[model samples]
Target: MSPRKKIVQAAFEKKKLNGVVARVGLVLDISGSMRNLYLNGTVQEVVERILAVASKFDDNQTLDVWIYDNEFSRLPSVKENGIENYVAKQILNNETLHKFGRNNEPLVMEDVIRKYTKEEPSTQPAFIVFINDGGVVKPTKKVIVESSTLPIFWQFVGIGNSDFELLRKLDEMEGRFVDNANFFHLDDISAISDENLYDHLLHEFPEWLQAVKSKGLVL
Candidate 1:
């Protein structure tokens, strides 16, 4: 019922999403910098809004949720029921300092790529929403470039006032099979219009989907 939630749901409804091959994934940055966002409830609202979008994807309306700093840990999927309490508890109860001060995206990506490929091995492309405060390392760029050929689209949403220098560079850094990564530096996430935010969030995904399919990356 919040504006952000309305925007996410409306944007999803506006898209011709039927038959779109997608598996939803939400990656939350639990770094020390993100602690304030968690305390102030922005992260919870974000999870709920994204969960609203994820529900449209499958019968269970569930999304894979992961929290990462230098490493990553998979949490219970965000389902349609009790989502708010579920998300809040996950953030509130966790050790915020778990491998603190590091945002090794490559480690997380490797885990996701390996787990999904071996366990599921489906052709459905994954839409990974990576929430962070702009701590992408050099190896992340290499891993991203290497993984561009895989069936996954990475949308990096930068929260807070950080410059997101590396993320911006990654956005313009090219020569992949297709543009698999998109970046947004949000000055005030709560103030953003849902329409605009969702537009940015979903914009590059459809194109990437087509490109991957055409290249025989997604069968």
Candidate 2:
């Protein structure tokens, strides 16, 4: 059996999955920077990546997604929610970061983590794939402090010229994976071709998933 199959089984027996339910959450970044021609448009790149991953799962599996910049962006434009639609809608509108009452935007990774744990207690092994072209905008400590108690696995991929050292530092930590914690830092979008991008996603997904599973998560 596949790793995903094994995990679904183990998590079912343990009754720790959030929603008793959806096995995954793909949190994508639809920030202003993704509008550039980095990857056949940011939305296309992300949508394609997600679809590929999802295609590998069992037919019965379900996954939820959220795109964030200023506020949380949902997917599907009268269509299946994925990288493609999200990119076209959010990117074209250029409102990826339209937050209210805030002079500056904050990274929602920590908040999303807490919300998942609280709103969907049955959702286990809540994996958050945080994509960004900028900094978290919130303090590193705040990200951890604001996170939920649920065990969240983070996969962060940063684009653009922003400082990615911090994101890298978080992923490499030896302790428990915290609220703002994640897996990668692909800072220079200009450098990553389609092959490079897809390969990174394919390679990292298994490694991180396995490592997290080895730690014995409920999922």
Best by TM-score: 1
TM-score per candidate, in order? 0.88, 0.60
lDDT of all predictions: 0.77, 0.50
What does candidate 1's lDDT look like per residue over 1-219, in tens digits? 755556666676677555565788888887777777778888877787677667666456788888888878888787867676665677567655263456778887787777567777777888889988866777888878888888888999998787678788865787787889888878777787667777888877877878888999887
After superposition, the stretches of candidate 1 with alpha carbons farther than 4 Å from their true spots are 1-10, 13-15, 95-100
Off by over 4 Å in 2: 1-22, 37-40, 57-63, 76-86, 90-107, 145-149, 171-180, 187-199, 202-219
lDDT of 2 by residue, 62-154 (tens): 445566666665444222334345555554555444522221224455456646666656424554556666666646444554442345555
Global lDDT of model 1? 0.77
RMSD of each candidate relative to the true structure: 2.6, 7.2
lDDT of 2: 0.50
- Scanning candidate 2 in windows of ten residues, the lowest lDDT window is 96-105
